[model samples]
Target chain A: MEVAYLGPIGSFSYRAVKLAFPDAKLTPVATLVDVIEAYEEGRVDLALVPIENSIEGPVNLTIDQLFHQSSAHVVAEIVLPIVQNLLVVDAKRAPEKIFSHPQALAQTREYLSEHFPQASSVPVASTALAAEIVQQHPTLAYAAVANLDAADFYGLVPLAKGIQDVAQNNTRFWVLGEKQPHIALPSTAQKVTLALTLPENLPGALHKAISTFAWRGIDMTKIESRPLKTVLGQYFFIIDLVSNDNIKYACKEMESLGITVRNLGKYCIYEGEK
Target chain B: MEVAYLGPIGSFSYRAVKLAFPDAKLTPVATLVDVIEAYEEGRVDLALVPIENSIEGPVNLTIDQLFHQSSAHVVAEIVLPIVQNLLVVDAKRAPEKIFSHPQALAQTREYLSEHFPQASSVPVASTALAAEIVQQHPTLAYAAVANLDAADFYGLVPLAKGIQDVAQNNTRFWVLGEKQPHIALPSTAQKVTLALTLPENLPGALHKAISTFAWRGIDMTKIESRPLKTVLGQYFFIIDLVSNDNIKYACKEMESLGITVRNLGKYCIYEGEK
Candidate 1:
């Protein structure tokens, strides 16, 4: 199997991909768009992308592209507890510039403000990319907020560990593939993901749509609303429901109400070590 | 009146603030957190912040800081049609780098990928800051994705205009203050924004909460799920409802179902010229 992920290598997505597909050949791409493109263009068997973080909410780029630009199905999920660390080439030197992916920068905002109040923070494409930049600019007083894996991979020193604002900073990554798994899914399979587009200007369309599963005793783990990208007030709901035999019936009932339901995937979730 | 906004000036938020309070004394701040802090600490009479965008959905930093850190109420809103432009110090020079706020960068991602595939895009604190950086470094081949206001403010040439991915790229900015408007709101006051926290692990809690307003014929203009920041799969719904007399009753009914609803504010909306 071949797997593609957003990376310069040593990113959280790379870690998740490694844990999920230990034997697969890994292809690291530069951006989330590239990761999806690699899967869509048949360059890789699967693509792993971060969908949400406990601290930052949903990754809008991934959600927007997943629903609007691609038709791939999510085959698996990995929940990784993110522990951001400050990496540097020379730990003794006080850094004047800090860098990381925007989300990582946000996760460590409080720490940065409290400690390095005068340092300038820069956002990059990925945390590992920040590490690479910091590694290459050894003479500059620069630091990166990334995972320990990045520090190890780039031979940078971890000046500080677990600098995220919150203690439970978990990020969820989805492995996207071209086809669904067989009907006899593993017993661990517990969640079904659906993207629902409700008809416009309807008062109770969203309520009615959720009721279909609610009335059936199905538990919804999450419900996120993203813009349909057409207008300001218009949105489509991305829902995560406990996998059940009655999901199809609920989807059918929703369809009858003029709600366009797209089954993105039904897959099991695995927890990654912190 | 004194107003604080996220700016070095010439930002979209600055434009919205100028339109909303043309006569007020404006105080430009560096970050969204500083804007809220200025309001909370009584440094400004009102603080203007970007709440949501048509293409990017909700502004997570603003939402999180508003609900979690402060108790201010949203007093008014301004919807501005965003038209991103490529700003350059030298129009004849081919740009090797692009810079903008992360939101602006994402908004113009498609345009950048199509027009300048080889240019490196840098994310900055604000679009105005990007224009400032580009202005100060005339020797470097750098461009900024910002509004016409920014380009004019920084004396930069507009290499391209209306370069956003979508035409309907509107952003909603909220003016937050300490007190409720004297109870006699204007006729244009049409929206009430609420943040609701549903009790843990309860099936249909969200459905039940929405149904309170839905069954009463109240139209919810928007519903966005944001992380509660406590754990994975937990969320708080930020709901925008069309202002109505029955909204209080709906809140009572939701409270009866054990939902914790925080009334952020009920405010009128204004539109800025494109």
Candidate 2:
């Protein structure tokens, strides 16, 4: 299989792809926007994109692209526990400056504040980009916060491990493409993503929309709302349901009530090794 | 009054402040996080922060900070139409690279793709930072997508004006402080921000929570949901109601039904000159 992910060989997306499909040929891209563009153009068979982190809520561009750009469906999801570490090179003493993506810096805030309060923090595009920069300037007193894979890929030594403030740091990644996943299922598709839009903005519009799931006792794993961009108060809601059967029922109920329902594909999420 | 705004000087927040308070003393800070930190520490009498753009929805850090860190209320708001300009030090040479904040870059995607398809784009912390970099390195073929004030502040010439894809680009800014606004009002506040959390996650919890407002004909101007951070699938709903009387009625109803509701603030939004 051919797969594309956010990488310079050692970002978290690279790790996610590795864990989910160990034998796939990997293509690395620079930006989230590029990933979607590449997938839409059929440059890669599958694109692995980070959807949300437990600490950071949601990755903004990924959400925007899923809403606005993709014709592809989410075939599967991979949940990876994030382990942030402080990696440095040739530093007999503490580094004066540290670099990482904005989300990484935020996740390790408490650790950095306690260990190196005086150090300056710089945000680059990604954790892999930070690791790459630290590699180019080997003589400078600089460090990075990234996954364990990045330290090995960039040839840096770990100064510290598990530096994230909250212990339960995890990210859920999606596999988007034309083909659906053949692995990790319980005979029934375990999850379904639905995008719904209201015909008009009214006081009870949202209440009526989600009640379809509530009335059926379908467990909604996630619900996110974004503005329709037509005017000030209009919005579209993305709902994640636990069962595909529930999705079928809800879509029919919603459409009958004049709400527009767009099914964004249904597949089982990868639940890790047996 | 002394106010803090997101800046390196001459960013959109600066423009928002100038329009809202014609005589207040201004102090520029680097990030949305910094602006709140400065405000909480009592270093500034007021902090002006961007809440949502008509295009970009809500600024994440601003929403997160106002939810987690502040005791301050939103006293007033300012709405400004955004006009992004491509500022270059010298229009004589074709630039090889362009820089701007990620949102600014996203807003001008069509313009960049059409005009400079071959140019590499760099994402900086702010649009002002991008302008500063282009100014300091004049020999490098670089340009920035920033406000008109940034072009004036950095002594750069405009390569283009109002290059945003959408003709109706606008942003809404909040004035956060301890006291209520003595400025524009109808003798009673028109808007009130409410943060509500459910006692537990259920299929229809959100449907029920929102129905309190829906049943009353309360016009919701905005509603944003963020993960509660305590667990996955749990969320806090930030609801912006248009009427103060409606907020009182809804809060009473929600509390009676065993839902938790926290009033963030009640303030009038600045409806510019007649």
Clash pairs, candidate 2, are none
Best-matching candidate per lDDT: 1
DockQ of 1: 0.39
Over A170-244, each residue of candidate 1 has an lDDT whose tens digit, in order, gives 678888986643221123446999999999855589888989988998888777787787766788889989899
Candidate 2: docking tier = acceptable
For model 1 chain A, where is the 10-residue window of minimal lDDT?
Answer: A180-189
Give the Cα lDDT of each candidate.
0.82, 0.76
**Candidate 1: Cα lDDT at B160:** 93
Residue-by-residue lDDT tens digits, candidate 2, B67-119? 76776788787767778989899999787899987667877888988998988
Which pairs clash in the backbone of model 1? none
Write the residue-wise lDDT of candidate 2 on A112-144 in tens digits.
Answer: 989999999987656777887888888899999
